[model samples]
Target chain A: MSSLAAPLPATATTAASPASHEDRSSFAFLAIASLFFVISGIVALLVAGKLQMPTLLGNIAWLTYGRMRPLHVNGMLFGWLLAADMGLAFYLVPRLCGVKLWSEKLGMATMYLWVVIILGAVVEIPLGHNQGLEYAELPTWLDVLVVVAWLMFAANIFMTVANRKYEQMYVSLWYIMGAIIWTAFVYLVGNFATLFTTGVNQANLNWFYVHNAVGLIFTPLGLALGYYFIPKAAEAPLYSHRLSMIGFWSLAFVYVWTGAHHMLHGPISQWLQTVSILFSVMLMIPVWTLVYNFFATMKGQWHQLKDNVPIKFMMTGTIFYLLTCFQGPMHSLRSVNAIVSKTDWIVGHAHMAVLGAFSFFAVGGAYYAIPRMLKTRLHSQALANASFWLWLVGGLSFFVSLWIGGFLQGLQWNDPSIPFIDTVKFMKPFWSVRLIGGTFMFGGILLFFWNLLATWLHRSERPAETV
Target chain B: MIKKIDKNNILFVAAATGFFAIGGILTTFAPPLLDASWAKPAPGLQNYPELAKGGDAHADLVMKGRAIYVRDGCWYCHTQQTRTIEADTVRSGWRDVRSPVSTPDEFVFDKPHLFGTRRVGPDLSRAGGKYDKQWHATHFKDPRSLVPGSAMPPFPWIANNPAELDAMVAYIQSLGRAKDWRPTHDYEE
Candidate 1:
């Protein structure tokens, strides 16, 4: 444990490196977003518990399972993960472009506006001001605010890149730029366009929004960070620029067609489902190419996993991304979709992508950037390592438990002889395991947030020699 | 052209957007607006008869009930779409009778469609008339009383507000019944 927690001497060189005075907004965004990360965990814990014992907060209309579920989903996806991604974007775009941000003031304004959007979600979603769409639950007005905030963010990123000193862009820039464009289109279609339509067509549109919200928005942001930080952590250049290009273009093409896979075996057209299945399988091409590129970059740097905390988080994220991508395409198969589409298995699979894969990348970004931004050593490396392990173990246990529980539940649902109540009863032990796993994961995130906050506050006893 | 895209930010953004729009337009944007079959309502949903049932006052209650259902996040747990699978047919059927597969017309009245992805409970697409309004009321008050070990949260607040409960029950009954396809008596176990 002592060796694992040993102080990183590399921080000294980075601390001596030139500080980007323009990164103030990045620092503020990362810190505030980390706060949401902690709060979202608390909401998730309560929601997980309520699933096992429905009456835990049964009487409270606001905390009921229905309202709480969306609150938890939106809070984590939008509030924590997305906000952190934006912060990473603010940090990466400028450095990669070799320029200060176009306007730090606008960046700060975007951060505050984002906080307001999340706070509005926290207040209004509980009051039943929901849109009733799974991921698009925020009311129409808040949706408008989100679009406005994103516009401000995109303006900053695009303007910064436009003024870049370097003519040739890195892979990270392409991903970030692609994400911004795709997000605007996907979000508007999901939140606004669906308003005019109802019934089956609306359901078709809803899933298009749901799947792309993850694929177009979070996936690109996560990859942008991973592309930047993975090589940085491994101390190597990307293995193949051509491979990265292939991965990007292919993903952009294949991902949008696969959203209908969510509706397989349902009432939507069979041709549409078939198209989705084909694209879903094709998704493996980009995922594997990216995996191969990352692993190849880290070819001889494998031993760094023992000592470098950020690389550990990132490499593990890469592996989770692989597993999640593999599982996702398989789930889209008609036979598999029949059993698991609505079961707890889908829930577990979702967490594997968001919590296990992308969350790790975002956390690694913080671990890599925060100290550099602050010009200080981390408050405690040991605590950071401990948080990583706890998070890994907790996330895996939570996923595996549900995978087993939901599979059996899906099998039982298919069997007419087994009563529905018995299937619900069978989930008890698995839910309990999930709750326990959630607790550890929550504890780890709390430590992570505290470490970063403590570093920002200069709370560490170590000398602040740089200042 | 590739070199120009690599060096020019605006050109690169244009290329990225172009690639994405192809798939987006093909899959999501085009289908509902242009497709012929998707616009056809099922015979039951051909008219908003369910909404017009019992004159304006009853229609108001049903609308209010739908609001409560959405507000309480009921759709998170219970899906409104019944797939064309044996499991759904077996599970949503009345006793041993197979309920009709959910057609597009069945959901014509559902604005912002409630075809939820997961079924934490059961698919409620054909849930209309499966049980009596009284049974739903009792279940809302205390789900465990009727179905022990049920994970459904008790909506005791709705019970306290009798009007709201009635509206919710009405809305629940209207789920698949907009077509009046099933006999109410056939649903009992």
Candidate 2:
């Protein structure tokens, strides 16, 4: 494994890289984010298992299946995934823009604010003070806190990019910039902070926000990292800069309109529904463009899949991204959605996209960037490789099991003669499979956290770490 | 070598633009094709019978139910509308042989049909006729006791308050009402 150490570029100094200070802040955020993810994953696994064996958990009011499930989701997405991605954005955006972070203090402060907002959720949601919107379930006060944190983050990033050291901005910079700015706008609008008085427009805003959070924020960041890291890791340039531009522009234009697809067959206006559906189907163009660029870039570099840990994570993520987006549009079609809308299928699809696609790339980017930034070798490539395989196997298993389970649940529910409770009975076996999948995914997450912690701690221990 | 805009890229962009244009045009000209059956008005609502005129009680119940649905965020997962037969009606209860399929016209008078698509819980479209008020109340209070492995979270607080429980039940029972409709014999109790 020491052979990996020899491959480090001699000029790559620990502190000389313009991004070292930013890396420290990013790493701190990521460590906290990883802790949150591990905690959330453990909670999810416990809840999934408890659903089948409710008596085992001794019915604590807050720990009950009803509350814990949403808590797990909120924690994982906002606390873990988004936090980690933000760390990546902070580190990568500065480097890609050919400048130092506009304000390291601002980045640190944003992290603190995020922690506070999520901590607020930890207290509020279990206390039964939620607004009851999935993803937007945080109490209205916490919602304001989150918006403020995001605004701070946006201002810092935009200012950094505006003061770039380079004249030509990379495609990755464009994506990251778009994600930060668009998220701030969408979050404000969707929360209806100004327009809504008594939370009457909660549904309209919740759907608008939750859907865009996934489509706009996470999706763009993931693609941005993919566009940057894929070529960089392969020691090659992008396949087609023009295609990347097309993908970015198209995704930006289409993703906002596509959120309403989640409300397919809803009570929303027919015009809104039709527009959402049309845009959803049209989302295929941008998705395909992205898929094409990633695959084309990897054409001659397929060998990297065997040797590079990060590439393994990233390529698999791209594949899942394709599958998730493809499935997303299909499910948006009124026909497929009828059976799978609220089922474990959508859950599976979400995980496939968010966890499977975005989390994969996020972790890969972290791993790839960490050793270089720290100017030290990774603690173990084997652990990194193991984490990749475990996540790959586990994520795929989750997607398959849940998709099938959701479809079956939908079918049984639609059968008017079948009592609703009986449909629950029918789902018992699938629920078991889902638990199994959740366990596998959680196990993988543990390995990843261990690997990351070991590397970070190991670097700190080195008395005089060198490039 | 950096190349200028080539024919291939132009063709691709043009094709994409054309697709969007055609979609916009089709949507503008034939808007009804997009209507889902769940959002459609029911026969009873569209063609009110003389017998339906006196049921202010049911209307009040429905109005109360609407409040509960909104308050609880039930619409997050369960849509009230069903789309046309071609639009995955089977999964959404629109084409279920045993259930009454809604037509587009049925929703003409609906302020906003609650026919949601996501089924975090089952569709509540025909829920009025299917389950008893007590069953719904129990299920709302604690979903797991009724459905062993439901992701649908229990709304226990709603039931703990008698007024709220009554209002919610009244609302659920009033969900799929038509102006001329009568309760099914099974639901009369």
Residues A216-246 of candidate 2 have per-residue lDDT tens digits of: 7899888889998899888878889889878
lDDT of 1 by residue, B9-104 (tens): 878888888898888888976776655667777665533435456467767777888888888888888887768888787777776777777776
DockQ values of all predictions: 0.79, 0.13
Q: What is the TM-score of chain A in candidate 1?
A: 0.95
In model 2 chain A, which range of ten residues has the least summed lDDT?
A1-10
Off by over 4 Å in 1: A1-19, A459-467, B46-55, B178-189
C-alpha RMSD of candidate 1: 4.3
CAPRI quality level assigned to candidate 1 from its DockQ score: medium
- What's model 1's overall lDDT? 0.85
Q: Which stretches of candidate 2 lie over 4 Å from their true place?
A: A1-21, A54-58, A193-205, A411-419, A461-466, B1-117, B125-171, B177-180, B183-189
Return the TM-score for candidate 1, rounded to 2 decimals: 0.95
On residues A245-355, what C-alpha lDDT tens digit does candidate 1 reach at each position? 999999988898888898888778888889899999999999999999999999989999997999999999999999999999999998898888899999899999999
